[model samples]
Target: MTDVAIIDYGMGNLRSVAKAIEHVAEGRAVTVTADPAVVRAAGRVVFPGQGAMPDCMRELDARGLRRAVLDAAHEKPFLGICIGQQMLFAHSAEGDVPGLGILPGEVVRFDDARMVAADGSRLKVPHMGWNEVWQAGPHPLWEGIEDGARFYFVHSYYVAPQEAGLTAAHTDYGVRFTSAVARANIFAAQFHPEKSAAAGLRLLSNFIRWAP
Candidate 1:
């Protein structure tokens, strides 16, 4: 069985993510871990979050798992979900907080000037509900997923990576923003695959089979 560690950084929906991985990977062993040592030993690490970027970074620093996760991302398969993906950047405009600096970019809040709501309600800040993803690269992590397939999203802020190649998929809210990113062994998604139904499951299964 493949050993997958879901980092418990006191932010993400760890239980839901673990359960989703189990459902997709079949008999694979999944553990919700907060220990850096345990995370270091895992074959793959899934960092999932759904809170402020700065608070998430603080939790990671306090637990001393930042280095372990970054090293794992370099040497092993790593997946970041929601704010977990945003934290991979250098900083976030959400709370004037510095991120893990693993990836080059910054998380910024959706601008009303650039966004337009169909209902015309000043464009909601937290972009909640299903949004279509337009695939960019030919990364194995997105195998079997169709372009423009809708995925579950619930985020107020979005990542804007400095490197364009890192963006694997994009979604349109008010403007087009990164929905997924992949660079070598590192992979991340702004959408919630656990709650995205069949398309999301297929995406996770692809990640399970992806080779770093």
Candidate 2:
């Protein structure tokens, strides 16, 4: 049974992510839960988030899912989306906050100097809407998706993994930033797959069937 647990720490778009997973789950069970037991027992885990880093971390701790998340990441196929991806790093510049330290890196703000497009148009902070992602290397989750496919994004800060080899995909905003990362059993995306349409769905579907 492909029992997948979407960790509900009170910040992510839980329902949307659950629905997407359910769409591709086939016979797998999908549940949005904050219970650590449920998270620990699931075959796969998805950590999705939107909003402030401190708030996300607070809720994660409040719900007592931090350790459960770490445990799950270590033992099974784990996916993190948006700020869910940022939190995996060592820290964040958003609120000068500390993250899970699962990955060796810090989350930093997009540089203020280059928030302008090449065509001389001003760009927004959230970096909302569609952008193309360049695959850095091969991985199971990227299987049916093209090398440069657009995905939905909504965030101001981005991850800076200490080691470059961990990066799975790259995207150009004001500056180039890490859009996705994959290493061993854990994979994460700085963009929101539930809102990313086809390419997003392909990634989610791959995550569902992924044995890694």
Candidate 3:
């Protein structure tokens, strides 16, 4: 059976992600590794991250897994979550840091002026808790998931791909932003699937069975 590898770059809740994957992984091996070799060897890769973009990038390079990550992203079925999704872009306004450049886009923060609900209430930054996600188009990762499902999210920054077609799904905070992206063998989401209850589990299960 093809094993699933969750890249441990020392950010985010790796254990929660690991446990969640293990729950839906069936008999497939789920290995959380900091080693580049293990990442390259795995059949599928889950790139997950949290915290600031600068720190995330620094730690990734510090561990010498940058090349391995890029390779796996290009060569295998890949899933990116939270900061993992942000890091895939070419740049981020968080620390004005450059990303993997795997996708042509930039990560931007929610505007303070626009952080208002329909009721004229102030919305907080980091955009925590559950929000509805609207599918941009059909995707394998979205299988078994409803078009507008609520997923757990906790981030201030969101991705804006130059190519609108790259967006797999979007969510509204202060504005409509790309909440998920899909291209080739890769699919990424700004939300935390592990924390998203039944809908989250369904998405992970779809990823496990997804060929691409």
Best by TM-score: 3
> What lDDT, from 0 to 1, does candidate 1 have?
0.87
Query: Could you give the C-alpha RMSD of every candidate to the true structure, in order shown?
Result: 1.6, 1.1, 1.0
lDDT of 1 by residue, 1-212 (tens): 33888898788567778888999887888889899888888888888988877788898889898998888888888998998899889989988988888999989899878677677656677899998999996888777888899999999899999999999999989889999999988999999998999998998888787788
Best by lDDT: 3
Error of 2 at 196 (Å): 1.0
**Residue 126 lDDT (model 3):** 74
lDDT by candidate, in order shown: 0.87, 0.92, 0.93
Query: For model 3, what is the error of residue 106's alpha carbon versus the real structure, in angstroms, after optimal superposition?
Result: 0.3
TM-scores for the candidates: 0.95, 0.97, 0.98
Of 1 and 2, which scores higher on TM-score? 2
- Model 3 segments beyond 4 Å from truth? none
lDDT over C-alpha atoms for residue 210 of model 1: 76
The deviation in Å at residue 156 for candidate 2 is: 0.3
**What is the lDDT ranking, best to worst?**
3, 2, 1
lDDT of 2 at 49: 89
